[model samples]
Target: MTQTASPLPERGPTGRRTAKGSLAAKSAQRVERPAPLRQVVYDALAELIINRTLEPGQHLVEADLAEYLGVSRQPVREALQRLQTEGWVDLRPAQGAFVHMPTDEEADQLLGVRAVLETHSARLAAGCASEAHVARLWELQNAGLEALAADDGEALVTANADLHSFLTELTGNAVLAELIGLVDRRVRWYYTPIARPRGHDAWAEHAELIEAVAAHDVEKAEKIMAHHTERTRQAFHERPEAARE
Candidate 1:
């Protein structure tokens, strides 16, 4: 009789493979780890800058920031260097690090691009938004209203971003969302000072946009978004002297 190849060893009833199993099965499992300290510090510092907690043109002392963040100075230094590269901080040869102050030209250029993107986002959202999506927009709008009533600047900023971001999501365009993400933080930085003063009118325009999207009125949605973003751009330009600094 012809010899046949030995049959493979049976796997354990519990499904654990024996040592004689496939080589791929013996590979080590991946170990998930916390983010590196330098990256964490970088994110924290970038957030502070965006939220206006670290005011534009304010000095960034590594020791003070390290102490505040409860980390060592090396990570803070690395984070500051990254922030400077990203235009969030300025590194002076003799004076050290300071927050980067945005100019009118910078604000206009960015906000103008934002208007174009957001208007397109609104038009697409109107065409495709489900009732559930519109309801979520209202919820975000209400959150912004509550934040405004409480005069909580930070919460207002967050809520405003949440509403706009959700609208961008309703557009069903990944590339558009990615473009918005690139400018979102700096837009927040420019918006923080104006969040309170612009709160009432901004939310009103949001209501109108939501209504247009809910009605599936594409042209109306686009028009409302265009106006809303232009108003924000105007608000930035007209911000008080203190806010400009």
Candidate 2:
């Protein structure tokens, strides 16, 4: 005679496995939803570095970071390695990790390339931006002005980036947008230190730039963007903290 198959595990009223089920099988079925420890650590440390919470050239010890982040040294070490590869941290052979200090030349080169890309973006945006795009640009401009008035440097910087990134998207050039995005984070890091000083002037320039785009004046839009980005490049060089090697 054929034997009957064993009954499948039963579920409780709560929809979980009953006590009769194997705990190991239940545990195995549960998947952790959070990011891996290493990525979490990397993101935390990167934010600190970008926002200047972890200043450039400051030494980073794995143990201290691990303790601060409530993790073990393994994840911290992994994070630092990844940060180094991404140019956010520099790992010396025996000296450990330090925040990467961007040189003036590096800043100039990146900003120069940014200005070129963004000038073209503005030219395209002037012709292509719809009434809705111009309205969004005005909204971002007002947000930046409000942030400046409130002395919220972080919010101002975010608004500034949002406005530019939106304009870049309006360019309708995927390749150009990708190139700008590649340098965007580093540009933000550079800009954060000078956000307060640059706040008023930057937003004012944004107002004129928006007008040019809204008028669909390609030449005026391109000129205003070039000037705006160049002024930012100059402001970065003028900051005292940026003088540090």
Candidate 3:
């Protein structure tokens, strides 16, 4: 009867029109491939631990992490393995992973090692530091002071890390640099909860250390660096929050 508009061009089973025009405007949509699944998991979990998003001694379930991160057990397993290597996590047989907590004694030992490494670092810096190196360290030191004055704990920590890394590089020995970097990471874990360090005192100390390095006064630089580590260690040891651990 009425020609039926040529049967309205029949539809697909799901009511999509069976025509080129209904398929796509130009091409099929392509999903963006994600990053390496293991990297994704490792970085995500590492950040969680570093930021204290996961509390010390909290159990980490592979299944839960896999589900939460939208990956499978494979990535989670790899990530946990990496965290264990970094000493940020512990894997107990059949007990699952837990965030690692270092005791005061362990912290003290790490800080002691840091002191030695950085003292040698300061000595080397005094021996061969360029004016530019000194300038750069000074810039970072000033920035760190400003961060502390503003009561910006996170910013101060980041700036402090930068200054330390700069000194590590300036030490000119790759081995010493590596050792300093390792200790630096350990130090920050304990330093985070401590109060904002006094900016002027810190800057003054840095300035004195820089001058000592510039003059190649190895003894002065070494002594200052040692005192700096000792002060930091004492502060951290007395910090009430650190006591909680």
Candidate 4:
């Protein structure tokens, strides 16, 4: 394996490096082990896809990634396989992987799932969320605002994830929370760069959602969240390329 380029560093909202190597490498394959190269490859590709660098329908070149990430072909192949399983990439037998362009029906289906799970989350949060949880969500909302103002696509993504995760935790339903968690990452993948231009109405939507949640308006919260998810689905189809931003 040739380490031709530096590993993909953990990036900040604006494509700056926020972290480097850790304190030490107490290395082992299993215990105290580094993340599998396949996972690193998966994250790198997903980030690129979510950031709009890897356009939808673009082919993913495994050999190129292997050389770029300082790994062997095996890991790159595995990562592409994982992405395929996650609905981000499509692979044909004897062919290769390309970015996934979900159909209008498919995007609607995804939004349906998000709507069901997240609306339930909002209702539960209204009943169960505490003062601190609401506060934390507000903090995350402000953070998202900052990212949007600064035009930091990645940071905006991170902040959005934080907000959803906070709401899930506040709901106090571990099972439902786990279910949402499974799809949450995928949701982020769909929205990160697309429909998120600076000064988009997205910030206002966030504030409205937050206010509904804080007011413990379960019906209002559920309705707004459902509408939000549906709007996102529409955006996805309206601009087919919005999947990659």
Candidate 5:
């Protein structure tokens, strides 16, 4: 005779399902786990790429990266595959992995989007800024100047980003801030090479922008920001080491 499977009993031998037993089904959901090794490796490699430590088109040898990151080849291989999917790396049939070299078109498109978002951000900031906010903007401007004077490219990039980021914060628009955050790292990556060359002029534009916001000159702030971002886009196109490959 064929037998049918029995359903799990709601009541235990004690005539009731214990609370502990009821919770067993939900235990796995509640347990927290640290990031997987592959994920951690992916983040580290992506940062290296974004910061230009892993320059575009550089060969990524799995064993070398594994040793450098103090992990085995497996996670590095996994991370590189993920990077390739995300356009940060390119995996070849026989040549292994390489960093993705952004084209002029790619840079232009991203910077163009950045200009639009930032122009609006400046306009909103001008209408919303207080004396305290203007002071913060000046503080950031001063920091940028100090970085420029010291010829510290890294610090200059950070200060430039900080000042722009503050303007977005002044807008009090979460959605706008999220949009800018998406492109922020890529913008930093592109800006790094031109940071020193663009330093003085960029900071001067920044000063004018701060003044417009301080005066609550909304239209002036918008126009200044549009010009400022367009100039940076042009500078990237004219970069001495312009990528042709």
Candidate 6:
């Protein structure tokens, strides 16, 4: 007599093994498509911290983060570790993680460095920017103006970042671009809270800087950019209460 054959096991939509699959099959599937849960958690936590949703000095409970992110505690722990390395979080032994509270000196130093890099970028952009690049700068300038007029703080901040990033790109220096990119996020975090108070004057300065760049006046562009960044740094220091709040 012929014996009855066992039916095939059910597979996932991607034809990967189901929970009932053999350990070897499951391991192979995980290897083929490694989960990026830690990275996802890291990005989410970073965004929250940068936007001040997770305020400086705020405690970061791994379990709470895992629950909030719909992830396991392991990924949250790994993400927090990475954030600590990047200066976004501070890990304390037995006390858990806390959002990093940047000191006044740290802010000043970083902004000063940004001023130097941006001034050089603006000068290079003035020399190398084509007509098309100038036109794009005008477009970003207009977008920033619109954001200001609408009193949209987030949009204004984003527009400001985009304009600066475009200028760096115009310089055609990959190394310079990379360095600016590294610092740009923290700069934006610092700038976001002050975006509204600084809106009108900032956009006007951007207009003048754009014009200088359009004219290919390297010295003028550098001077304007230097002044522009310095003003922002001063504004941040002047509004300490606003930044803390």
Specify the highest-TM-score model's number: 1
Q: List candidate 1 segments past 4 Å from native.
A: 1-30
TM-score, prediction 2: 0.82
Candidates by TM-score, descending order = 1, 6, 5, 2, 4, 3
Task: Point out where model 2 deviates above 4 Å.
Answer: 1-35, 241-245
For model 5, the superposed segments whose C-alpha errors exceed 4 Å read 1-35, 242-245
User: What are the per-model C-alpha RMSD values against the true structure?
Assistant: 16.8, 15.0, 16.0, 8.5, 16.0, 13.1
Query: Once model 1 is optimally superposed onto the true structure by TM-score, how far is the C-alpha of residue 26 displaced, in angstroms?
Result: 8.1
Model 3 spans with C-alpha error above 4 angstroms:
1-36, 63-70, 92-95, 195-203, 242-245
lDDT of 1: 0.87
Question: Whole-model Cα lDDT per candidate?
Answer: 0.87, 0.84, 0.74, 0.73, 0.86, 0.84
lDDT measured at residue 187 in model 1 versus the true structure, 0 to 100: 90
- Give the TM-scores of the predictions, in the order they appear: 0.88, 0.82, 0.74, 0.78, 0.83, 0.83
Candidate 4: list runs displaced more than 4 Å.
1-31, 93-95, 197-199, 240-245
Q: Provide the lowest-lDDT 10-residue window in model 4.
A: 10-19
Candidate that scores best on lDDT:
1
Q: Which stretches of candidate 6 lie over 4 Å from their true place?
A: 1-35
Q: Write the per-residue lDDT of candidate 5 for residues 74-112, one digit (tens) a residue.
A: 998899998899788988796668788887899999999
Tens digit of per-residue lDDT, candidate 1, span 1-245: 11125332222332211345685577776689988989988988899889876777777878777777777889999999999999999998977888888899999999999999999999999999999999999999999999999999899999999998999987889999999999999899999999988989999999999999999999999999999999999999888877775
**Model 3 lDDT per residue over 1-245, tens place:** 01122222222232221337767666776778878768877877776665555656667777666766666789889989999998989888866687787677987898899889888888888988988988888888788878877888767767877887888797779988877766676577666656364345555777888889888899999999998878778877776754355
Candidate 3: TM-score?
A: 0.74
Q: Ten residues in a row with the worst lDDT in model 3?
A: 1-10
Residue pairs clashing in model 5 are: none
